[model samples]
Target: MSLVVTATGTEVGKTVVSALLLARYRQASYWKPVASGACEGSDSETVQRLAPEGTRILEEGYSFDPPVSPHLAARWAGESIEVERLVPKGRESGLVIEGIGGVMVPLRDDGVLFLDLLVQWGQPCLLVASSQLGTLNHTLLSLAALRAQRVPVAGVVLNGPPNRDNREAIERFGEVEVIAELPVLDPLNRSTVTQAASGFDTAGQLAGLLDQSQGECR
Candidate 1:
């Protein structure tokens, strides 16, 4: 079973949230299906470094050398990212599947969006959001997009300075849980992830979803 981790937008700490889940969930593995910055660094590399020791990393569906949008990066590589291959088969180990960019990021020129990919996977998602100014709008809009696509969002994780007012506004208007408020760590390392993960309550929220998804296979 896999639990998808998406963001309100790019650089919203989606990978960090996935690392936190991998650290907290003993049975969890990590996978980022499509990577654009393979030359610079891959999210899978960060997860392997931050996840608990000996964690399993599933290879990506596709990788491009440039740090760009999947559509552009794939084009630069003289290929296209097939929408169907992005959804991996269900696995025995629990998985934290990291999504690319935001919900509406185009996976290819033909107009397959990440939100569409989420719908195809039919997996409950954890939205990673920023806590800086203007987050309320982005977070709320993100929730709306997910709802419009009929993707079950498990909750949200605010990954920036702690702002009670904004957090409350999101919860009040969006009607979704904020599972954790991760402070900006000076140095992001395993210790920081472990200490910060105590603030997260997403594993329990996702437990039932993963159990049911895996149970259907059995």
Candidate 2:
């Protein structure tokens, strides 16, 4: 089954972790629907640059000029983001979909949320969180939000310097596994991605999330 990568908030190294996962799982595909930024490039572009060669990256679902929330961005652009059309026609093994912002961000005014897409996909997700002190609250809250919506979690990936205490706290109280603790990269590059990938096995970490048989069509 396809996997999704979401975060507690923006700029939490979610894309970096996605890159590392793609680097480790060479056959994996990456998709980031409803992207808001376009100056530096989309999140899919960042993944394409950092992921291992031959990674199948899909086009963004909807792109906005301003780097703002999907709802605002789409409103400013005079376009409606449709959730029904956003779901992948089929699932593929190692298909890693990335969501914009946090799980609660809205895509449109009809109460469609990023979490709604995750619930529709009905697959487990890898929640990326900061390893800093404030992460405990944010992490647990995000976990609760996902569970409240009936979303299955693949696990958590704390993105920052190793914070054993924070990790333990999340694992103990959050009731979700800490898949890996990714340290900050010195000079973020392909090499850095490969190095970070060593922290977790590609398939081992995702086995629980991938429920459907590989390469199965819908």
- Cα lDDT tens digits, model 1, 75-161, are 888898888767665754677889999999998898888888999989889999999898888999889999998999988889888
lDDT of 2 by residue, 126-206 (tens): 999999989999999999999998998889999898999999999999999998888888899987888777656544657
169: Cα error in model 1, Å: 0.4
Model 2 gets an lDDT of 0.82
Question: Candidate 2, after superposition: displacement of residue 171 in Å?
Answer: 0.6
lDDT of each: 0.83, 0.82
- Give me the runs in candidate 1 sitting further than 4 Å from their true place: 210-218
Q: What's model 1's TM-score? A: 0.92
Alpha carbon deviation, residue 213, candidate 2 (Å): 9.7
